[model samples]
Target: MKFGRRQFIGTTVGAAAALSAPAVLGQARPRVVVIGGGAGGATAARYVAKDSKGAIDVTLIEPTRRYYTCFFSNLYIGGFHEMAALGHGYGKLASDYGVNVLHDYAIGVDRGAKTVALAGGGSVPYDRLILSPGIDFKEGSVPGWDLTSQNAMPHAYKGGTQAELLKAQVEAMPEGGVFCMVAPPNPYRCPPGPYERVSMVAHVLKARNPTAKILIVDPKPKFSKQALFEEGWQDHYAGMVDRIGPDFGGDVVEVRPDSMEVVIDGTVEKVDVCNVIPAMKAGHIAALAGVTDEAGWAPVVPASMQSRMDENIHVLGDAAQQGDMPKSGFAANSQAKVCAMAVRAALTGSKVFPAKFSNTCWSLIETDDGVKVGATYKPTEEKIAKVDGFISQTGEAAGLRKRTYEESIGWYAGITADMFG
Candidate 1:
């Protein structure tokens, strides 16, 4: 069957009959198909599968055999953490949690039929659908920046091939070579990520090439955890890192990968290594489904994370337009739990429970020291609001910094356990 936009909505009557016929009266359980088994989708699949205890069949569709979290990826480049530590397989979700993990990309959602079509040629029908496909780069947002140029100037935001590429480039740089990082504008993934990356890279460069430099080209004047990151850079690297914010005429508009140079509004600067984080939008799936708004983010009801345009589908994680919540792994994981509970309540005709969300992101400045920002939140009427949290305090004692670094590792272990193990 050709599953076009018209066909999807036109066959709902027949689809509803097929879904409600013998299956409703049979011994089988309600099925939930989740697209993208990353931070959000994997957590939702595991929770729904475990909570329902065979009363809910959870199927997760992801293109990759494994997932590498963007969190703690900077440590890999700094030579402080291994890539294996940042990687996770989906075996636990499948075997222990009883989730059906499909290693294929979701091409489209047949919302009217409550089914998800796979790029590998098949569709999985569901009683409910949860989508968290993450962000996709907006093409032509930056002149001369696209897929082909990405290979040369890696955007390590995705945390896989790009991470490896960035690490290799950093390690191969000559003594005292300049490493240029082009930070994206506001409302990008991991708001503090590019800055943290510069800190970690500076740490490595200082150890290997004492005179090496890090030049950051930012579009914004300030960033998340700006004070703490700046203090850490000064205390640790000692002027090895230099930041050029928008006020300082550092807005990048073009890139020339052929010469390993970046142009900030006509001024060209050559560098030994270049890491460009491009503008991003909701994943292609969200846009194709017509759930994303003009801002290129999926709009959903805060209480349930259900799409305002389509009740059968819910969007979460980076694809969602949840205000006051930064797009981090912790935020995605928390949102997934809320989305999971909402899906369960809707499928069983039960009342939805109140959601308490949490997010914490840690950026390692050095091997023994790290900085973090976190908050706990809840839905208030139409938006998510933070209840309480803290950012790492600057000039903290050595012992406190050490403790924070240890706490970050613990948090990572705990969240990963909750999501997959």
Candidate 2:
């Protein structure tokens, strides 16, 4: 309806203003990227995607298409369970929870720009970043222990490749061969894992080759569920499993993988099969980002799970510095939920709440018997504190151990469902 030049100019201005209104007023949903879809990252992605609905976008970056949990891998070594059972798929996170799962490793983190650099030549931008890349073996911590040497002396604690190597070694040993395992120092992932692995391997040896022996050279004076483990060893596989704690002159200072020997107190002991669980640190990505301390663990606020160095990023799982909590799969999953809630609050300007976490670790002593330790925790001002905990009592009846074994399988099913389903 413009008739003159001034009227025409006025009409054009009004139409342009109307066209730009929605673009200015309607905001886009915030994006969250999680690196390492193992225990912590998978749960965090699932929770954030489900809880946020359409208000948040979640992407999970992991190098593996499927996850092989270290939780029950000892059973696989013992032939009590198949490797298939320990492996999990991410279909639920992608289909049901609407999470974008990327099978790629994160190489770097650009905190200022909030972008995660991928190893496969791409960068993903995010409003919030959560990293749970798990533990990395500290190079040079043990002489003759490096990525190449790991192929010979496998540390099956990390699952995947190491698990396979150890399993193959166990299968190939002679009837009277000796298997040696050097347990890592304190503050490693899965405190009971190495011991459980030794127990399970001994169980296999007892059945396949009764004359075989397993020697555990532990750096610590004791380990998680030490009494229970020793009891199980004595009751089930006596003369097969021999453990040497620090008190018994059992500390490994160096490894000679080529010679199939480990040097402890300047003495070299040759073995048919060797597994060296060296000292662990945070994943390389976290260390490269400067989020980890000299101890190689990332520090975070107990209540918020927010990085002490970077507020926009949160660290969880084994990579995080969570004391008083054993680095178990259940612990990582619990930490993930807490981190999801914290991220939700940060994005929406809602109140950040205190965190409560729980951990339960189950290990198979034999084919039908299992042992477990669990705890419930609450965050204090500075750290996460354990509130209540329990371990499988010594001298427990066979029926009780059997029931615990069944219960452990059920727990595994339930946990994976809760994490990915």
Candidate 3:
């Protein structure tokens, strides 16, 4: 029946803990753990830390300290940019933004315990967890191809060393050798990525190995910016590139990495280099977290980017099954901003604002020839719905195309700065 002054303070703080953190109590700050350090995860971690201003403890978990962005990596393969340019480090995020950067892979998520198990023999607790683990290749999606065959037949889809490998293989092709690309199916990362990479490879082959041939076996009948890419191939790299759509047996394909062969609809074709971009799903860790659906993508509340399965967990970027937005770096970054704001509001009693998302995917067809597709989005009752859109016209002026290319370069620089710093 005796309530001391210390007991009164404890009860008050406990009652207000859910609403706001006590600045004078010396209690531990709220913890936010983010997995993956690319477009979405890095941006989320940076924004939450920078915006929170030390009100929350933010930790970013990534296996690589220097993240090689999947976006703009094609430019490296095309010789427009260097591999070093695509790589971004987390030093600034740690120093300037006060984010705890951990170079460790997330092996498991103990959701009930609100902790994540790392491969490096430790577990970290989190008040909020953000999963932005980009993408993972779906096994058996392309027969005869897996990570084991990556060295002989590179996918080069996730950026970094794979891109280097693919470029080297393309440059090493003997005169008039065939360079084959097995493009992935729908709902893959960067819908335009495979096509842009093909264009870059064609660009490389034209300059170094003029007589070399390029081939693309695409499961889909049409792809992102298909018309513009076709026009550029005809106008610039004419008589060099050939594509086989589903109607031409592209839908059913296999590969033999040892012999460098592609089998399309039971027709075996020998090739010099094989770049197999297989079907993709959310990175494996999302499933490990028990946040992903049967379709291999994590479903999120379109407004907040929070996991549908767990309110304390959020998913972003390529891992999220938000509607309409393409699986692209731009989309992921945009979603990250929205997610960050919602998270700050939820955890820190910050101002809550309306969520608006936008995405633009730019592709370089040839030198200074750029095409882009973009749309603005808003949250609806069911999903993130598109509001307005834009695309590069097939016959845009040369000057305009050059400007688009310049714009994409600026975007790359800007986004890297935004994410890393």
Model 2, range 44-148, lDDT digits (tens) per residue?
Answer: 898777766646789999999889987778888888778887888999899999999999889899888889998899899999999989899988877778888
Q: For residues 28-122, could you state the per-residue lDDT of candidate 3 as single tens digits?
A: 88899999999999989998888777888999999997899989889999999989888889999999999999999999999999999999998
The local distance difference test score of each candidate is 0.80, 0.81, 0.88
RMSD of 2: 12.8
Number of backbone-clashing residue pairs for each candidate, in the order shown: 0, 0, 0
**lDDT score, candidate 1:** 0.80
> After best superposition, candidate 3 residue 306: deviation in angstroms?
0.5
Clashing pairs in 1: none
TM-score of 2: 0.92
TM agreement with the true structure for every prediction: 0.92, 0.92, 0.94
Task: Tell me how far the alpha carbon of residue 212 in candidate 2 is from the true structure, in angstroms, after superposition.
Answer: 1.1
Give the lDDT of residue 193 in candidate 2.
Answer: 92
Candidate 1 vs 2: which has more lDDT: 2
Question: In lDDT terms, which candidate is top?
Answer: 3
Clashing pairs in 3: none
